[model samples]
Structures are given as structure tokens and as C-alpha cells.
Target: MKSVTRSLRVLEAVAQHQPVTVGELTKLFGLPKSTVQRTLVTLAEAGWLRANRKDTTRWEIGARVLAVRPAALQGSSLFAAAREPMIRLRDQVNETIHLSVPDALHSMVVVDRVDCAHAVRTFHAIGDTSPLHATATGHAVLAHLAKSELDEFTAGTLKEYGEETITDPGELRAELRRVKDRGYAVNHNQYLQGVCAIAAPVLDGDGVPLAAVAASLPESRFASGLLPELGRMVTDTAAEITARHPR
Candidate 1:
């Protein structure tokens, strides 16, 4: 417990002061040099901090730390509200169902999820970020954003997680528009090959998209002309969540 507190303290310090060396952090935190070094090493291993390869003594906040924020909404009613709907979607479609909310800068953080008992299941961690342009959940949320927001989000370079990832801005814009027109989204071997997912937006009381709910299954299971039915199931589940829980 003491060590865990120290680790969090180290992270807080690093987050406050970036590009600082271990010696400097030790002095600032008033901890021993050995203790600080060990903490830095452990944090880097767990993806909380990234060590400087050139200096080997300096550390910076890692991507994972930024990706997985401490659960600020822990024990919130949002998860409880979405639980039954997500389970019903999973059971109806016999696929993995998930709800993800937007996190910092182009990251979608998983808040709640339900999985099917099929021989093949889609495994996703609670706080994992699905690529924005390649995932149905991320696409559904992004599609509802205003034009300016979408432009800013896609202005920078895009990463291609799979062959079907939309790296071009024009192509991605077209896809988002299609999602808006259809009132749902679909991704086929985009983020991960052999995986397919369909999703819809969950709106708040103000009619703004607060989160996205998705059903994911392997392409083999969905290849038999079941796309329309799967999409309807996802859309209906999202609507149910939106109606039951107003953000």
C-alpha cells in the first residue's frame, strides 16, 4: 500500500513536471534516489511512464497513462443504467457489446461492456481506446460531431491499424456522413482484420451523443447476410440505453 501511494505520487509529480530526470524528481518529492528510480522503472513497465532511451535517466508520461485516466466516474449510475441494455444486445446478437465514451484527444475509453459465450469472442479491456477511423463505436461518436470538430480531429496524421483503416481525410469524412445518414455505423476489417462491428450513438437529454454502443463479432459469424439484422440490434440497443439513461 505504501509503495502504491508512492507510485501514484511519482506519477502526479511527473505529470506536473515533464521531461524531468530521476535525480530531480527524487529531490522534488523528498524521496530517496533508489526509491524514485525503482518507482520510475515500475511505472515505465506498466506503461505509466516512458523512459528516455538516449538519457536512460529521464522519464515522461507514457501513452497508456494518458489513455487510462483514473476512474473519475467510478460507481456512477451511467454504467448501471447501460448494463442491462448492453447484456440484452449481446444476447440478441450473440456478439460482444460495449459502451465507450470519448477521452482526451482522439481516444475512446470503454466504460461498460458485455460479452457473449460464443466459441470466438472479442476481447477488449475496459479502458482501451479503439482507433477513431477504424472502429464502429468510435466512428458513431465521431460522426455526430459538428463539422469543425471533425475537421480538427482529422487534421493531423492518421494511423492505419489495418489495411482498411481510412487514413485519408476526404474518405473518412464521407464515411462519417454515411454513418449520419444511416443513423448507425459499421466497420469491416478496419481496426482488426477478421473482426466486424456495428454501432449507434447514445444521446443525452439534450439530444447530444454522449457515448456509443457497439456489437462486435468475427466476420465469419456475420458473413451470412446478417449485417442488416446486426445493425438493427445495435441501433435498437443504443436507443434503449439513451431512453433509459439521459447521460
Candidate 2:
């Protein structure tokens, strides 16, 4: 019984201070280093935690954690705030819309979506996750990250998902700059070869991104000329969601 309780506590601690090291957890919990290390290893084996790719000694929440809480956002303020705006965006653009939140710095997890009527539209399941540097939804959030956080992210490997994926850190940084300047991000077969998307960050009172709102369509239906129009619509929807979100 005590062992189970200890494991749960360790899990919660890891979540609160994610990417935390064994040494830090030991000091915080007043536990032996071996005990904390053992609990982390156990949780990692169970898929509730994973070692940070950038620093193997630090731990963070794993994909299984996001996978298990499929309905987590449904009851939240962000989901409620985004629901109407997302639907309206979908209707206006006739493209699939997604509402996603960053999972630490590793990925963006889709929490809600509004599907277009198009038979060949792009689709993302509610719990689907996409790489942070390989999608419009991700770039929207990354464009607003604090400098230190962005640096940490860039320091790690930027895995390529497709030919358009920006594996070069310098190039990705330049793209983020443009996203910030334009108040939105655009992806043309960056994450998926046949999909294209435009997205904007939903910022809080302090301008920190809480989530991203995106409009996605099949690449066949997308054209370079549509960027300005789609970008404006997505950014407007994101702003509406942000204004409606509770502080």
C-alpha cells in the first residue's frame, strides 16, 4: 500500500516539475536518491513517464499520460471557449479545424476538432499528437514560447517528418520569427505530405500561448494565394477564443 502511494506521489511530483532530475526529486521529497530513481524507472516502464530526449537524466510526462486523459479538455474553459470559434472557423473556411495544446515541448495534442463537410478533408483524432516543429499548430505555440524555453527546444533534435519539415534549427528559428510577425503560422506538407494548415496561438492575459487553433485542408485544395485569407481567419478565431477563455 505504501509503495503504491509513494509511486503516485512521485508521479505527481514529476508532472509538476517535469524534465526534473533524480537529484532534484530527492531534495524535494527528502527521499533517498535510489528510492526516487527506482520510482521514476518504474513509472517510465509503465509508460506514465519518459526520460527527456534532450537530457536523459531528466524525466517528463509520457505519451501514455496524454493518451489516457482523452476527455480532459472537454470540461475545461479553453475547450468551451474554443468550441464555438472553432466551429465558426470550420464553417467559414470549409476546412477541418483543430484545437491543440502543447504537451511540454515535445508535441501538440489535439483536444478538440471541428470537421468540414469536404469528403477529402484533413483529419486529426482528438488525442492525436504532432511534433512541435513540424506542424502549423506547433509553430503557432512555439512562436510565443519564452526565449529560454525556445532555446531548450531548439537545442534538442528536430526530427524530420517529411521533406518540408524544417530539420535545420536556424531555418526553423527564422520561420518562427515570421510566425510572430504575422500572428500566425502556415504549414505546407510539413508534417504530413498531403495536408496543409494555418494556425494561430491562443494567448492568455500575459501573452503566453495556452493553445493553438488551426484550419487544415487537403494539400490538393490549398494554394499559396489562400494564405493571407486563411491566416487572417485562423488568427481571428484564435483571438476570439483567447478573449473568451477564463483568466
Candidate 3:
């Protein structure tokens, strides 16, 4: 019984401080390293946690958690506010529209999606996660982060997803600055080859980013001439979502 209780506590801790190292968990719980590791392994085996993709030693919440609490993704006020706007954006661009929220400072998790009519449209499951430096949604959120938070995020390793991924710290910083100035971010086969996206941050009343709204489509459909128009449409939809969402 005590072991089960400990495992539950460890699971809660992992959810709160995701992408956390086992050593950090041990220190937080004041437990033996072996004991904490065992607890983590148990939770992971039970589908409550999974190791970070970039750093295997660190753990984050797993898909099963989302599967169990489906309402947390679709029943929230953010989803309610974003639904109509997302549908409108998809209709305007004829591309898949995604609403994603940051999972701590590591990754962005897709919370909702409005699919386009085209058979060749992009798709991301509700719980799909993507690196912050490798997707337009992630970059939009990163561009709105507070300076200290941005500094801390930039200090971490930027894992490369593909050749287009910005692995250099300086380059990423520059790109984020550009995103901040332009009110949106764009990705060209950065995270997934043959995929393209444009996104804008949904900011709260205080200007803190709450989520990002992105238009995702195939590379074949992402023409240079259409980028400006797509960017404007996406940013406008994101702004509408921000207005509709309660701060």
C-alpha cells in the first residue's frame, strides 16, 4: 500500500515538473536514488510517464494521462473559445488548424484541431507533442515568453529534428525576435519533412502567451506568394481567439 502511495506521489510530481530528471525527483522526495528510479519505472510502465525524447534521462507526462482525462483537452474554456475560430481559419486557408499549449518549457502539446476538407491535409492528434524550436506553434509561444524564461529556455540544448531545425542558440534567438516583431512564426519542414506551418501566439490580457494557433499544410501547398496572406489570416484568427478566451 505504501509503495502504491509513493508511486502516485511520484506520478503527480512528474506531471507538475515534467521533463524532470530522476536525480531531481529523488532530491525533491528525499528518497534513495534506487527507490525513486523504481517508482519512476513503475509509473512509466503503467503509461503515466515517458522519458523526454531529446534527453532520455528526464521524464514527462505520457499520452495515457491525456487519454484518461480527455475532457482536459476538449472541455476547457480555451478549447471552447478556439473551436469556432479554428474552424474559420481552416475554412479560410483550407488547411489543418491546430491549437497547442506549451508543456512547461520543453514542448507544445496539441489540444485541439480543426481538419480541412482536403485529403492531403496535415494532421496532429490531440495529444501530439512537438519541440519548441522545431515548430511554428512552439516558436510563437517562445517568442512571447518573458525574458528570464526565454533565457532559461535558450540555455537548454536545442535538439535538431531535421536540417531546417534551428539548432544554433544565436540563430534561434534571432528567429524568435523576428517572430515577436512580426506577430507570427513560420516553419518549413523543420520538425517533419514535407510539412509547413504558420502560427501566431494567443496572448492573455497581460501579454503572456496562453497558447498558439497554427495553420498546418503540406509543403506542396505552401507557396511563397501565399505566405503573406496566410500569415495575416492566421494572426487575425489567433487574435480573435485571444479576445474570446477569458483571461
Candidate 4:
């Protein structure tokens, strides 16, 4: 039980600061240097983190996390159907568009992304994870969860990551209700500062949300007045993708 707790703590620390050094992780976790070193070695052996190719002393997320992509995304029709829509969304708004799916850990993981052709745009790695309560992509899918799943997901403490992140489950539930009432979710400086995003879910045949399609951009580029049309565009694109591929 103690090792299990420590393992999760170590993984959380790595998530917070990737490409980090063993010495830094030791200080961050307040664990002995030897303990941290051994934990790193164990985790590396188990394919959680690996020595950075550029800097041997630093470690980054490893195959175990990244391997989720090939299995979670590649074999599915969702991945194939999502590509053109993702590209279309990127071209339509010239903003970063991402496809994210829920993970077992109450987080949304980016399965694919279409980058905007701009000097500055939102970017996230394929396997990067975001808390369901704070991210637009997360809310889009989470909003349609069954009551039991919603209860289990919201039972944990919600961490505030950005200025406007909703921490209260009641408040989150209300916002999710709005998401369900509508067909999309919006986040303004909730996941990251100076960034705004809108997302819509791609639902399966029975109306279960399979994933979320998001358009993310810098706050300056995300003109407040244009939100309605932007939200509609994403929802429409998501609907198109779902229609193209049903279980």
C-alpha cells in the first residue's frame, strides 16, 4: 500500500514536471535520494518514464503512456474518421483542433491534434492528459456521462489549475447540465491562462459520448462575440464525425 501510494505520487510529480531530473524529483517529493533513484529506475523499467534523449540526466514520459495512442486510437474507426474533420476544423478557424478521449483516471487524453498555421497556437502532445473538470475537451465528454460514472468521477477532490477553474462539484454539475442541454462545452481560462477553448462531443449510436472535438486558441484570437458560431461549428463537425462512424 505504501509503495502504491508512492508510485502514484511519483507519477503525479512527473506529470507536473516532465523532462525533470532525479535530484529535482527527490526534492519535490521530499523522499530520500536513494528512494527517488530507485523509484525512477523501477518506473523506467516498467516503461513509465525514460531518460531524455537530449539530456541523459532528465526523464520524460515513456512508452507505457504513449503506447496508449496506438491501441486507444489507431485501431479504431474514430481515429480514421476524425482526421479529416480535425483538419477541416483547423483550416476553418486556423486554430489548434484536438480529439480527446476519456481515460480511466478521470482525465481526458489527447488522441490526435491538427496544428494551426500560425506563429502562436495552442498545442498539446498526443498523450497529454487534462483534468475532466477543468478542460473544455473533458467537459464535452463528461457532460453526458451516466449518473453512476459522473458520481464516481466527481467523488475525488477537484484541483484548481487555472484562474476560473470550477472546483465545486455542484457548480461543475450545473455547467455539465448546460453542456448536456446544449451540445458543447466552453472553457475560458479554466485549463490554462490566456487560452480559451470550445468543445463538442462525438456520440455513439445510443447517444454515449465517445470523444470530444475541440478548437483551442489564444484568448486574444478568441473574440468573445464569436463564441456562438464557433461552438456551433465544433458541434456540427463532431456530429458529422459521429454520423460517419457508429458502433
Of the candidates shown, which would achieve the greatest lDDT relative to the real structure? 2
lDDT of candidate model 4 versus the reference: 0.88
Q: Against the true structure, candidate 2 has what lDDT?
A: 0.92
Candidate 2, which ten residues in sequence have the lowest lDDT sum? 66-75
Task: Give the runs in model 3 whose Cα sits over 4 Å from its true position.
Answer: 1-68
lDDT of 4 by residue, 93-201 (tens): 8999999988864789888899999998888887688988999989988888888998988899999986699999999999999998888899999988988899999
Model 2, which residues run further than 4 Å from truth? 1-71
Top model number, TM-score:
4
Using TM-score, rank the candidates from best to worst. Answer: 4, 3, 2, 1
RMSD of each: 7.7, 8.2, 6.2, 3.8
Q: Model-by-model lDDT, in order?
A: 0.82, 0.92, 0.91, 0.88
lDDT of 3 by residue, 1-247 (tens): 9998998889878876888999999999999999999988888898889999999999998888978766675688888899999998888888999999998997898888889999888989876789999999999999999999989999999988889999998999999999999889999999999999999999999999999999999999999898888999999999999999998
Better candidate by TM-score, 1 or 3: 3
Off by over 4 Å in 1: 1-74
- Per-residue error for 117 in candidate 2, Å, reads 0.4
lDDT string for model 2 (11-30, tens) is 87887678899999999999
Model 2 alpha-carbon miss at residue 48, Å: 13
lDDT of 1 by residue, 1-247 (tens): 9999999989877865677898899889898899999999999998989976776667888988766554544455667668888888877877888889876446777877787999888877766677777889888988888778887989989899878899999999999999988888998888888888889998887766788999888888767377678778888888888888844
TM-score of every model versus the real structure: 0.73, 0.74, 0.77, 0.79
